[model samples]
Target: MSTLTIIWIALPFFVGFISYLLPRFDRIFSLGVAIASTGYALWLYTQPPLKLQLLDNFGVTLLLDPLSGFFILTNGLVTAAVILYCWNSGKTAFFYMQTIILNGSVNAAFACTDFISLYVALEVISIAAFLLIAYPRTDRAIWVSLRYLFTSNVAMLFYLVGAVLVYKASHSFAFAGLRESPPEALALIFLGLLVKGGIFVSGLWLPLTHSESETPVSAMLSGAVVKAGVLPLVRCALLVPEVDPLIRGLGVGTALLGVGYAVFEKDTKRMLAFHTVSQLGFILAAPEVGGFYALTHGLVKSALFLIAGVLPSRNLKELQHQPIHTPIWIALVIASFSISGFPLLSGFGAKVLTMKSLLPWQVIGMNTAALGTAISFAKLIFLPHQKQEKQGKIQPGFWAAIALLIGGLFLANIAYYEAYSFENIIKPLATIALGWLAYFLIFRQTTVKLPRLLEQFDHLIGVMSLMLILLFWMVLA
Candidate 1:
């Protein structure tokens, strides 16, 4: 089992190097590799949890528990979807090579049992992501990708310092003695995680980055890569459950901050990007269900971003005029409903569990965010729908990606679902109805103007610096 696990972890990197050797068939080979990896991930989910020791002297090890296994399965599915979406992208061999390396890095990061291993794996992911985002090498792409890498590296700096402090206090790198670690170190670690996880103010880089990158790259960023921060964040939260209240408070603020932009934003991908921040808040609000919620969000969101890939324009003013392919429209409707907590779906089941754990104020905050999601997604779902021309055939790979997510959605609903009551049925319906009403009203009346500072790189770095100081002060106090 350990050998198979190692193979599963290394499979993508190996196949990717082979793609480099045979550049001409890189696309075909990448697709084949992605499909195989997805199957392997599912197999891994069925096996009992295990740990593998790699460097006993350095205390480096890999651990796989239910949480790690959940992310492993998620990374595989999201990666396959990305490759399938990019199958006809006409990218160079280097592009596919970087992608598979990124794939392996995410797998490694999720499997790491120690802070240093996890941090190193995450940095590798950052490097690959920077390469992918800057694939065009245009001035804007380069700048955007540079900032993305810059922010990620800065966040990791906080994590590294925290880890060193933790080691000093606990004399080990593993999670075993985390309770003995100082609140100061844990505070710094989670602060970094919050930024990487795309929560509110610290994650302000998300909108510009996710919106500006190429469609497949955007899907990868939102769908899988940004998730690198979440596993560690949730892991830390679990080991020190005393911080649950603080995490939940941030969750509420993140949800509000995310939806505030999304509700009024005009750019389609940018709006969805903010929604990503908001959805992470939903998971943070219920960290115990982090694995399930993350899986559902990853699948549903990648599909949405892929659909965004095919659109004529990400701007709603232009997009509403163009007819959506019937298939794309179907995907939009289902995904939007799934995200907004409609009945008999993954979002509804996740929300049901989430609400059970929330205080009254938190529940109210979540409902407000749900309304914003509905309002924002209305931009896509209500667009004119029509059939495709005979010559314009949607690729089976595209449908395959959507099919996998839809299936995952149903499966999540089944697994998490308890029972449905009248309020469960009516509440989501009311939210959607009210959201659409508010959308139309707001659409005619005014536009939500985001502060220009949010887009400035200097502003983002300044905000992050401010956050770091505030975090230290709070922890020390």
Candidate 2:
């Protein structure tokens, strides 16, 4: 098991490095590696959970429990999808290399049990992501990537400080030791995770980065990478269940704000990016359900971003004039519905399970977000004013990704039938209906202008810092 774990972690990095040397066949080689890696991860699921100790004195370890195992598998699937999508996109060898390294780093982050290991994995992911975001080399891309690099470093500072504080008190870097640390350290840690997790204010860098990046990169950023932060937060929640309510409240706030901004967004990718934050709210409020939600969202959101990339225009009004490919449209519709909590879909199942234990206010907030999602996505169904020539053939890899995502949506409901009942499906159906109705009655003809505060990085960082202070006070008080 330890050997297998090591192989899984190191395979991508090795392949990535080798691919750089074989530039002509980089795409083919990376694709093959992705497929094999994903297959191996799935195979690992059949075996019992495993814990491997890589270092004795330094406490370096990898624990593949149910939570980490699920995330690892999901990461593998998404990485394969990303590689496939990029296979024919004419990217350079360096792009392929970075993608592979990014996948390995995320997998390592998921598998690591110690804080130091997790931090190192996260930093690798951050560096890879920064490079990927800047891969386009456009002025805007460089600016956005730089902003992400700076903000993430600041967030890491918070995490390091918190880790240091925890080590000082507990004298260990493992989660078990950190369980006894002070609330101040925990609050600092949560703040950093929230930043990386793409929570509204804390994750202010998300929208710009997700909206501006290359299609495949955007998919990975929104889908798999952001979850790296949430994984640790889930661990923290386990250590301190008392903070669940605080986390839930912050999640609700992030969700509502995300929907609010998404409702007014005109750029197709930007709207989807905001919805990422909103969906994350649901996950934070219910980590158990979050696993399924994150998995479903990662797949669906990646597909949507890819579809957006192929579109002639990203503006909703302009999109209504361009002829869209049938498979792309089908995938887009399914993904939109999945995110909006249509009954019998992945999002619906996750929402049902998440709401089962929520407070009334939280339930109301979630339903409202659902309604907002429905209203916001309604624009997608609008047909072009004039029919035009269909776009180029959709890639086989993209089609495969869509199919897998749709399958995951169905499986989320079927596999979790023990937690999902017929009664549980009712609310989401009603919510969807209400959302469409509201869209028709009100938002269809009107557009609200958002302040576009996210683009102002300085303001966002200040606000994020204030929120962290408030969180510390709330937790310590």
Candidate 3:
């Protein structure tokens, strides 16, 4: 088991290095590595939980329990899909290298049982993501990547300090050890993870970062990387259940704010980015079932971003005149409806799980977010029919991703069948209907401009600092 764990962590980086050295076969090599890594993770999922002490005196440990196993499996599958999509997309060798490194870093983050290891893994992932975001190196892309770097660094500073505090308080960095630490330390750590988790206010950098990058990069960012933050947040929730109320409150707020901004978004990618924030709100509110939601969102949201990438234009208004391929069109529609919580899709199951423990008002807020999501995506159904243009066949990787995502949607239903009742399924359908009505009544033919507060990096940093101080005070008091 230990030997397998070591191989799983090292395989991506090793393959990435080989790809960098042999640029001619980077795509094929990376694709093969991804398939192997994903297959290994599936095998690992079927085994009993395993723990290995890498450095006994230093307290470094690797643990693979059910939760971590689930994330590792998701990471493997998403990375494979991403590699497949990028195969024919004209990415350079360095792009493959960074993707591979990021894949390993994410796996490491999920598998680590200690705080220091997790923090280091997260930083590695962040650095790789920053480089990937800046790969296009356009003026806008560079600026957005820089902002992401700065914000992520600040969040990590919090994490580092909090880790020190936690170690000082508990004399150990393990999750089990931190269970009894002071609330102040836990709050600090949680705040740091929240920034990465796409929580509202703290995660102001997410929308631009996710929307501005290349489509494949955006898909990975939205689909996989953001969840890195949430994984630790889940750990925090387990250790410190007292924070559940605050998490739920912030979750609902983030959901409403995300969808509110998304409804007015003109760019297709940016709209999906905002919905990422909103969907994250549901996960935060229901930490108990958050993993299930994250898995579903990661798959469907990645497909949505990939579909956007394949489109002729990024603007929703221009889609009508664009000659979209039929399979791509079907995939886009399925993803759009899935995200909007249409019945019988993965999103429906995730939404049901998210709302299972919510209070009445919280449920109302989530429903409203769903309605906004529907309204925003309703624009896609109006795709203008144009004569089919002669185009090359879509790659097998693209088809594979779409099929996996659609399959994931149905599989979620089967996996959580006990959670699905007539009422639960009916609610999402009703929500979609209300969303369409709300779209016509409120959002149709109206343009709403978001305030520039979130766009200002300095202002966001200041707000984040203030929130951290307030949280500390609340805990200490």
lDDT value, residue 293 of candidate 1: 76
Clashing pairs in 2: none
Q: What is the C-alpha lDDT of each candidate?
A: 0.80, 0.79, 0.79
In the order shown, the candidates' Cα RMSDs to the true structure are: 2.2, 2.1, 2.3
Could you give candidate 1's per-residue lDDT for residues 1-477 as a string of tens digits?
A: 888778877787888889899998887777676666667666766777787887565667887777776677777788777777666756789988888888888888888878888888888999999999999999999999999999878888988888898899888888654578887787778767777778768989998999899877887788777778877767766767666676787788888899888878888898889989998888788778777777878888888887787777788888778887787788888988898888878878777777777777788898888888888887777888888775254554677777877788888788765647878778888988998898787753466677768668788777877777766666555
* Candidate 1: stretches off by over 4 Å: 388-396, 419-421
Off by over 4 Å in 2: 359-361, 383-397, 418-420
After superposition, candidate 3 runs with Cα above 4 Å error: 320-325, 359-361, 392-397, 473-477
Could you tell me how far off, in angstroms, the CA of residue 477 lies in candidate 1 after the best superposition? 5.9
Tens digit of lDDT per residue, candidate 3, span 1-477? Answer: 788778878888898999899999888877777677667766776789898888675567887776765566667667778887776777899999999899889888878878899888888988999899999889988988888888888888988888888888788888765567777777778778878777887877788889989888898888888888877777666657666666777788888888888999878899899989988887877777787788788888888888787788888767756767776777788888888777767777777778787767687787777778888888775566444578655555787777766787777667777656889878878877887887778776677777767668887688778779767775665
Q: Is candidate 1 or candidate 2 better by TM-score?
A: 2
lDDT of 2 by residue, 380-476 (tens): 6553433346547555567666666577678756766665567766777777778788777887677777776656889767866786788889887
